[model samples]
Target chain A: MSTPVQAPEAGQATAPRRLGRGTLRFLLPPKVIAGFAVVGPMEGKGPMAGYMDTTLEDTYYGERCWERTESKMLKEAVQQAIARAGLSEQDVDVALTTDLLNQCVGSSFAMRSVQVPHVGIFCACAGFASGLALAASLVDGGFARAAVVGASSHHDAAERQYRFPTELGIQRPPTAQWTVTGAGAVVVTGGDAAGPMQITHATLGQVRDMGLKDPYDMGSAMVPAAAETLVRHLQETGRRVEDYDWVLTGDLGRVGSRILIDWLKERHGIDIDGRHSDCGAMMYDASEQDVHAGGSGLGASACVVSGYLFKAMGRGLVNRVLLIGTGSLHSPTTHFQGESIPVVAHAVCLERPGTR
Target chain B: MSTPVQAPEAGQATAPRRLGRGTLRFLLPPKVIAGFAVVGPMEGKGPMAGYMDTTLEDTYYGERCWERTESKMLKEAVQQAIARAGLSEQDVDVALTTDLLNQCVGSSFAMRSVQVPHVGIFCACAGFASGLALAASLVDGGFARAAVVGASSHHDAAERQYRFPTELGIQRPPTAQWTVTGAGAVVVTGGDAAGPMQITHATLGQVRDMGLKDPYDMGSAMVPAAAETLVRHLQETGRRVEDYDWVLTGDLGRVGSRILIDWLKERHGIDIDGRHSDCGAMMYDASEQDVHAGGSGLGASACVVSGYLFKAMGRGLVNRVLLIGTGSLHSPTTHFQGESIPVVAHAVCLERPGTR
Candidate 1:
């Protein structure tokens, strides 16, 4: 059953003053009550298939269009997350969600059925972290008792908008990554009721342009952003690479993840080789799947972090974790105009109570 | 000049835990230090032209591409705003900005030049208030000392993506609202450094659909959302319609504002006649500009509020104000699919010092 949330007393305020300049030190961190993932057939068949709550036998998901299917998946994810938390839509105070579609169509349309307060945000692939951060802020600031954060990305829909249509079946580049087809949803509340899934701190990142115009090589373009956020988060929070049980990136793919590792070591002397892993690389079996670099999309990081990691943490297998969400901000028009790509990353500290 | 920000002591913690359910009570409401607006020649010739800091001789703004021009205007608006605040980009903790372009290209790219932390949000025409609301939260929650909110829209760019190309010169319907060509920027900071421009409360809105499918007639589609938020805000804040010196709505255009006013009186027994005005209606003279119903876009509301209203508050010409930002949550594809348009409205309560 759902219950009202209250802020922790002054004496219970455990966090240090807001870290650095752009970090939120949640004195009473919000809890992740439940999470759910819905993936397409290909993604369901991948290495991370077991983590998903539902996987469509076909990409259409019985919808007429791929965009419609995306909306369905997002709505289902929200419903499943609420059901898992034993709460109904009526109990939710608000929903913070977004996707890659123009005007955030997927989030707005999908969430319309719920009828709760909502705000469709846009942070590109970093949407998952952005939604989570805002949801946590809403809960921590006592604006909502329960805030739902959701996002989705469909291969069919994304391909035509960002690249070529699926009907073309154009030859793919080795550097290009597959857009994961799925949706992820999480229910965030104020307190430690959801024990192993507490959100303690957040570091919002700035935009970084790297002069890479090729959309296919987005992985390469997103490296600086991931590294920048990681360094700032570590420095501001007084945290070391080893402090986290796992440091996960949104969708850096194989190439970008390696670049991040190398850059961190060279620039900050911070080596996270053993402790760091990327959602993109973890989404599929790189060699077996045709996805050249790895899997990437808003869904990749969201599904992995919420579906896979939440269960892992619940089993006491993993404890403290840092999720660094990376997004390459660009439009087809901007790219066509020969402009550089702008990227960003936001990091959130999640942990089990025992680990803290 | 630029100083590191610190959280205030206990006595200075003047706000409640948070405002009403849907509102964020900024214990330490962030102050609007400065704002700037830049517009195209068409908008410069309108009624609100004097509110703009600069009016371009042409929509091209000396850029090769019209979209590039939009980016330039946004960048200049931000730079002017920061300078007016007596600071530079380095002094900014973060920038929360967005625009009408796909993937928020304009804001992200223009903001990359600033090199501060950036969060590209997308809420359609609600972007200005969305940006300001989030910026205020970042400051109030101790995440940033100085935050910048920016947004832009170019008529040529919006026409091409949302409708036919500018070259097409298609005849628009009477209900169609013209997208404004301009950008607006506001600098926000924690504490009350800018005494006359404090943001006190915010009410995030929910998605509302009235089964309207025409994209061109967005004003009619957005009326329900505007009314919903206005009523909720008034109910929660326990304020009468006359409490505010002004109640401004973002780009509902001529037709939508009339519908909103009628609905308010009929549904809530609230008559906001003389105290209220729509940014869309004020941006242009419907009879003279041939903008159909009126003006629409993030730039419309953003410019009026940040540029004109900020100055008014500073000079004691206005005291209490409520800005309700409305957004249409639909895309071209959604319309093609015959889906009903979804709309949203967010309200931010702003005031001059000594009113609290």
Candidate 2:
């Protein structure tokens, strides 16, 4: 193997001269004219009763877990979002999508059926926020007139790839949340109309290695990184906890959510009491939802924000929201390294101009 | 499990209202400010002998493959493009990236190491043009001021996933091209600058099944899709075959290239003989570069265009260029369905205003 080479220092010789900026710059920004969400059919439904179940038998790719079941959920979510935004497929200039599949199977395949110009994205669970940031930037930059950001996840599919099969009787940790098999999408356009909220500012956190292991415990793995990024975003954008009516994270589950709240108070001296919640926790309503934790990348938070919260926003139940997504930076190596998992986070603040 | 509920129609009743026009909008159009390319250490000197060596180690992760190895090369190419663009990481509003990894491991992980706001994307091999289209739209929609589009592919990594391990002596078909383990990135920004050309328009093709079985034979799997999208783009934009100085596809190896050309002529009657080329064919000298069929995804076309062609444009070697990325819509199920592989294509046109 070639000797490990060092990445060039900022402004150093041998470094690409223009790579000095530590952050992305925006020439234009997207106005969130409207957004929509679709909750997956799996929510409220019991564990996908295995391939033997009648529903599973029908949807399964001939009884294979790798089949494209998630595509259906994704398409539904996107269609709902587009409709909510009062836009047609023809009006969408770009489709920015991401998912948990290895090569973005959900988004790519979903777009195949939708027939929209698409650019699939992947950032683990953090993809939703990252995609939103990009779409907003694209709209702000004048590169597109309108765009869509979407993501999805399926428990049966994720379990097969990341853990033991359901029939194997593997013990899932209390912190491990069932991967929600659902999809959520939002439409960002340049011109304004009545919508839930306008995306004010988006801040991205750098990937940091806090040295956590165990990809299964994504909440614990991601909390520190999520905390760091959320704090940094508030600082960089010159916003404070009080500014947002609600501060939300994608899928921190019950365990991660508590840890995050504590971290915010102790580390950042921020208090997020009633104003803070989690998509993971809200998706199934702790009691009704069997997912021990709350939500994860696929469609957990996406459905809540787009379906429940967005609907609420449209009805004038809520006015402003700050959505942050957390992702674990663990790869097969990180798992093999016995090293602590690194994590990343991104935040997008949304507000309605004339809402309460 | 819930039974498969019928999906709502596009304009079905009870659907959410769409956002009307005249809403607040942001538009930032991207201009090709500059571009560059750089061959990384893995290019000629590495554990793998030259770029054709079947074995390579992943930079971020261990265990070598053509995919990860090529990703490192694409990273260097992107660095060069950023340098040529005369922009820093901070200048980039969003770093839009994609690759062929099941989880987009190369692009997402590599992006964490970079300082830009990373948004990893995927569309299989079609990622290059898809990214360009999205980036350009971001610029045109006023979402970002400047952005970068990147893609990469590796032989070692891809081979292990698609076919027998290098350790296993396996016969391969000539139609199968070794995935080029390389990376390429391009910087797109708003406003004018000295560069090859401005991106005029981008169009995407629908995914269609042509009943291709072997995942290795991507050329045949993708040719039809490429033809359909390219023709549609031309017709929609009201441009004829000779409008572009050059029209290129991502990686249609010799066999697929011929097929695509023939199909285009037969189907669209728009002759693009000398004007058309493939990134897969151009990346290496046929004899010297053991890439039998051509490159796929990853940095295949992006690297070539940004590194080689962008540089040529800077030196006044060329003026206008049209890049098209083709992707194979082959899922594990396409094989099961006894279906032919469907293909999809996306295209972006770039040109120097004054010179052209």
Candidate 3:
């Protein structure tokens, strides 16, 4: 405790929790006490089906629009999280969330009825990790006692916005990623560990672009950005690949995850083979599900981390874990306008307190 | 100082800075050292054109795409801000930014090469104030030594993404506000006041929906949310209209600002008539410029406050100020699907630190 994670400067008493270039050491780590996931029919039938708190047979979820439906999915997940934690909506101090929709209306509309003070964030697919990192920071900084973080994406909605309308039944390439239809929410509280996992540190990523302009090749675009954050996190924390039992990415999907692993080995000489997994790749059986590349979206990582990873920790299947939420920042309009894709990835270390 | 703004409940020495039901009181206010604004061709001809840091004769700003132009506009603004603050990029510990584009590509891509650790936020037009509030909080919480907050909007890009392609020359309603093509950036730091103004307090608004679903009528949608935060800030801080020299709304425009004033008077019995003005209304001559409702977008408020008001304060022409940033939350898809528009507003108190 005396030495602390960050060393004090010549004039400072408590060192600013700056880890390396972009990583942050949360001296006061926040506990992840509760989480919930809701998925659409397609996602409900995926590999992580058993992990979902609820699966909808109706994609609309009784809403007229896919955007509103996505909002409902997020709202229900957060509400379920608070209820599962044995608290009322009033007890959650803040809500950090965003969706795939423009202006993040899904989150704002959801929060309208939920009524918690909101901090809206947008990071494409990386929203889950981004939101969690911010909420944890707020909690550690004593800004909030309890923070509810949520993210969501609906396939039909994303398809229309990013590409052609679903009614067109547009042919997709093998490199295309199917946006997952679902929502995930997690409750983070600043206090003694009251749950199976706690967020100990976070590395905020830099926007990275390697001239990958093809919107269909997003996995390739995000892979290096993911590597950047992971490497920065390990170097900053002075940890190795062996430090974490599992190194999970929100949604690097199948092709990207493999490329990322090989790239990490070649570039940084860090080989994370058996320990690595991607929420995108693990969420679905690509061939069986007809999801060409793999799953990808804000909901993909949110569902995997909040539902699968949290439950796994609770069940003692996994203890120490590193969750890297990756996002590919591009739009069809921008793509048409000849812009290269920019990607970002955020990494947070999670652990079962006693095990760590 | 002993009798802190937030009265402790029972067993606390310093209150946690929670005021009334929703507002936050900063025990250590953060200083606003420098701010810069860059605007496009149309905006360069506006009323406050003389106040901008940089203005472009070409709306494209030499970029092939509007999104990239907007990003460049934001980058230049931040660079100008750091220069004006007598600091370098290395002095900025963190960058907070957002834009109207999907995934906030304008900001993410702009930040890709800026090399600053980033926090990507999305609250539509309210991004300037929202980003600054969070940056101030990070500085006050010791997460950042100095934080740079940036936001931007491009008229052509927004039109295509939100409605139609600019080539279509879409017919517009009188209620529709023109999207100001511009960017703004502010440098916030902890420690002594670097200039005339400091952020003293902030009230994060809850999402409010009044069932108005038209995308063009954003100003009307956001008016109530703006009023709510203003009233809450006043009641929580136990301050009256006389407490601040001016209370400004981000981009409520003409119609919305008038509605807000009347609503505050009728609903809360608080009349702030002569002392109030909106950045939207002040940005352009509505009738003469053919900007029907008035100027709007992330650039509207950002350009007015950071470029115009910040300079005014430094010149000792103004003292106390309250900036209420308003955002309308709705998508064209959601609107067509019959969902109501949701809105949010954030209020931050600014003042001359020593005088206060």
Predicted structure with the largest lDDT when compared to the true one: 1
Summarize candidate 1's per-residue lDDT along A105-154 as a digit string, tens digits. Answer: 88888977876778777888888987888778777766678888999998
Q: Indicate whether candidate 1 or candidate 2 has the larger TM-score.
A: 1
Q: Residues A13-36, candidate 3: write the lDDT tens digits.
A: 355566654566666678889999
The TM-score of predicted model 1 comes to 0.95
* Winner of 1 and 2 under DockQ: 1
Using lDDT as the yardstick, the better of models 1 and 2 is 1
* lDDT score, candidate 3, position B251: 88
Model 3 lDDT, residue A171, Cα: 90
**Over the stretch B1-356, how does candidate 2's per-residue lDDT look in tens digits?**
11112232234223211111111111222467655443333333321223221222434334344444444555565666677677776677667777665566666556655666665666678887777776676555444567887777665666665555777867777888767666767788763443445665666555565656677687877887778767766666556767677788887878889888888888778788888888777766666665567555555676667666765655665666768888765545345545345566777776554432
Residue-by-residue lDDT tens digits, candidate 1, B186-300: 8999766755588877888888898999898999999898888888888877778787877899988888888888889998899888888888888887778889898999988
Local lDDT at A10 for model 2:
38
Please rank every candidate by TM-score, starting with the best. 1, 3, 2
Query: How much lDDT does each candidate structure score?
Result: 0.84, 0.63, 0.82
Alpha-carbon interface RMSD of model 1? 1.8
Off by over 4 Å in 3: A1-15, B1-15, B20-22, B165-171
Residue clash pairs of candidate 3? none
The best-first sequence of candidates by lDDT reads 1, 3, 2
Specify the poorest-scoring 10-residue window by lDDT in model 1 chain A: A1-10
